[model samples]
Target: MSKNIIITGTSRGIGFELVQLFAKADYNVLALSRNSKPIEALELKNVIALSFDLSKKDDYKKVESFIGSNWKQVDVLIHNAGTLLNKPFVETSMEDFEHVYKTNVFGVTELTRIAIPFMQRTSHVVTISSMGGVQGSMKFPGLAAYSSSKGAVITLTELLAEEYKETGPSFNVLALGAVQTEMLEEAFPGYQAPTTALEMAQYIFDFSLNGNKYYNGKILQVSSSTP
Candidate 1:
């Protein structure tokens, strides 16, 4: 049977490429993004694209309903959608932090909560984080809100893995470096990244399928160069 996969942030960059990779591999993909036009335009086979906003509580129900009505099971769930704010800490407002956390942290939590019941021991949950989230690593200015939100998800993944260890649905997070995506450009303008969106998505696509075999609740640093 073809596996059912849910991937967020599918409007562009890594998430966009990921949707294609899974679809071409014969997996049933549910691509969610705030803007569904990009994925819908592709018209790929075995794929369903929805305009989903992570920060909105109601958006999760749409995902649950889709699964319940069509898939009835989730083989993989990848939290790839994230919001980034490029502003100095002193200049960033409380709303800025909340906005970032809303989507990156709380959003991940709610979706996983809704999807867990549909997943089995063999299921995998892959979260796409950033190297900026890694402690003791190089820190950059003007990213207090964005980077911290990414960091929060790292811990969230760890806790979920431990809690679910006895039951199933292995969890792991990838702390990626500067990938040449729109998000990267927004964070650091004009700075070219060594890896492309497709390249990174390819790695994530493979890992999401097999990494659970040997690892769980671990943070893998996937970066070739610093930002």
Candidate 2:
């Protein structure tokens, strides 16, 4: 039987490309996003599309119920969906921070919580973090909120790995550098990134498939020196 994988933020960017990679490899790809059109357009039989606002607590039941009813085992769960609020700390409002955290942190937490029941013993749960979240990295002035949110997930993933060690599943986080995506463009307008969305997607795909063999409760940094 083919493995089953769940990926969030699948409407575009790294998430979208991941859907393609997994689906092409014959994995049952359950793709979730707030909007469904982009994924639906792929028209792949192995791909299942789900729609819900990740930031909202109420929307989670749709995902939980769907997976609960249909799949007994999930081989992988990738938390690739996130948001950014690029503004100076002084100007960043509480709403902006909350908005970013809702999806970047809380959403990932809740989704992973609900997904654990269905995960197989060897399942890999992965979170896509940011380079800005890494300590000793050069800090940007306008990314206080976004970086903090990513940093929170990095820590959370580590804690989860330790807590779940007795269990069979593995948990890991990837602290990524700048990628060529709309999110990156939006966060740093006109800045060129060496890594493309598809490139990052490929890396994530390989990691999800086999990373657990070598890593668990670790944060791997992926980036070029130039950023």
Top model number, lDDT: 1
> Candidate 2 on 1-227: residue-level lDDT in tens?
89999999999999999999999999998899998899999899889998878888888888888887888788999999988888878899999999999999999999999899888769999999998998887678899999999999999988999989988589999999989998998888999989889999999999998999999999999988534
State in Å the error of residue 84, model 1.
Answer: 0.6
Output the worst ten-in-a-row residue range by lDDT, candidate 1: 55-64
For model 1, the stretches where C-alpha displacement exceeds 4 angstroms are none
lDDT of each: 0.95, 0.91
163-202: candidate 1 lDDT, tens digit per residue: 9999999999999999999999999999999999999999
TM-score for each prediction?
A: 0.99, 0.97
Error of 1 at 80 (Å): 0.5
TM-score of 1: 0.99
Q: Note the residue pairs that clash in candidate 2.
A: none
